[model samples]
Target: MTHIRNIYCIGLNYVKHAAEMGNRVPEEPLIFSKPTHSFVKTDGNPIELPADKGEIHFETEIVLYIDKKPDPEFKVEDVVGKIALGIDFTLREVQTKLKQNGQPWLRAKGFKNAAVVTDFWDYPGTDICRNTEFSLVKNNETVQQGKAENMIFDFHELIKECDENFGLDQGDLIFTGTPEGVGKTEDGDEFILIWDGKEKGRFVTNLK
Candidate 1:
């Protein structure tokens, strides 16, 4: 079996997502981590949607694959590596309940196959650091859309915070975060994650 590493996730990086999450405005990037086993590859595989969990939602995000260990002062340029676009499957109802109860987000957000990533590619270009379009479609209907520039915290800052606490090593994957317009997905729901103009990946959830 393949060994799993750390699973890092950014929350409310996008301003619109923050608003949808009921925050007036994000003061800083919300960050979270999940076990590496949380990863789910969306390449024609069947995802078992949790029945007990209400309203499982799809959050399309750009995933970063680090190629080197970063020092405390590591700069984004120094952390040259691969970037893959993917989806962050979330339990929206559970997450909201947890937040209301002031509980941790793990149980709701860190289930098996919660993090879906694609084959890593070398960081496309510095332009990706600014505005890059990311979107998701379910059953051929557009559901989510937002640009990286809309993120309250940009890529550079996100990487700095990630390196400071987690210290990324080669093969470490970080989910930048999702945008607004998040909604629930059901069994047989075919979905796709798109970055810029390229089709990143697609998957369908299996009925419980």
Candidate 2:
């Protein structure tokens, strides 16, 4: 397994997602972070989540894996060494409260095992990535679907934002935002992450 360093996430990158969340689409990429402890693999184990915590919503995203420090004139194709389908689990109630209080979203977004990723696969180039569609299936029903072309801030722009502000390093990950159709997750819900119409990962939920 590749050692993960930083886990950067983009919120409201998709226009429809922004609208569904009742927020206007931003002119720039909305970036956030999840602690390293939030990372988890899709191994055959149940993902334990907070049962008492208000509704937890699932946001499926296309995750990029940085293999090395990028050059000043790095090409988007050169920056992403691997790709995977991942989930940005959100505690909706906590997030709303934090937003209302104008607080950082770490408490609502950075819980343990909050970031779930599929097995890494080689980067399939810009054209393929733009054309590929990824989705999340909850209990055999497709809950969320997204394509790169639908992104407001494309991959190149996202990389630029991260590098300019946070400085990307090898082993850093970017969870490029989710699409519409996000909903509440219940205990025993089975989630299957599909990339390019193929199943890449699956896991069951155990809300405690």
Candidate 3:
């Protein structure tokens, strides 16, 4: 099991994604969270969608693991840890209605099986912070692609914001939002993330 103490998610981090979703590029990062228990095993365990939770959608993001407390004052290089490309699964209908009514939208995103992550890859050392890539391939075609250089709120900024809102500690996670091409998911769909040119089998989601 992947150990997770707290989960923090960043929304609208990618400028293109924000525009496509009809949102403005935020002045700062938009952050959300999935409960610690929401992380399911990707060690061959299937991703199950909530069958009754309206229409389920998939958003691919680059996930960060916090190794230490973040500093609002220190340079970004000092706070981040390992990285992984993960899915921030969502209930699109639930979210849209909530947004219209001005409600907290966690209920639409932070549900059981709403979060599933791949094994962590060590953060590209200080020399390489923005070269990482996040790609989601459905079936055989590339559906979404986001680069670190493209994030409106980069990892360091997100960590600072996350610590600002909730104190950060070892074992906390920060999911740095999704890129464009988010769409409804179907049963037996396999998502493979082409992370920085490397192929990682995310899941085929045996949704029941």
- Most TM-score-accurate candidate: 2
Model 1, poorest ten-residue lDDT window? 1-10
Runs in model 1 deviating more than 4 A are 1-4
Give per-residue CA lDDT, model 1, range 40-125, as digits (tens). Answer: 77667887768777888888887777767777677666675777777777888888899999999998888888887766667876
Better of 1 and 2 by lDDT: 2
* Candidate 3 local lDDT, 1-208, one digit each (tens): 4468999888888888888889989998788788876786556656788777688888988778887786547655566677777889998899999999999988898888888888887777633647766689988889998777778877767877788778888888888888899988888888887777887646777666
Order the numbered candidates by TM-score, best leading.
2, 3, 1
Best by lDDT: 2
Give Cα distance to truth, residue 24, candidate 3, Å.
Answer: 1.5
Misplaced by over 4 Å in model 3 are none
Please identify model 2 stretches exceeding 4 Å from their true place.
Answer: none
Screening candidate 1 with a backbone cut-off below 3 angstroms (N, C-alpha, C), the clashing residue pairs are: none
* Ranking of models by lDDT: 2, 3, 1
Against the hidden true structure, what lDDT does model 2 obtain? 0.93
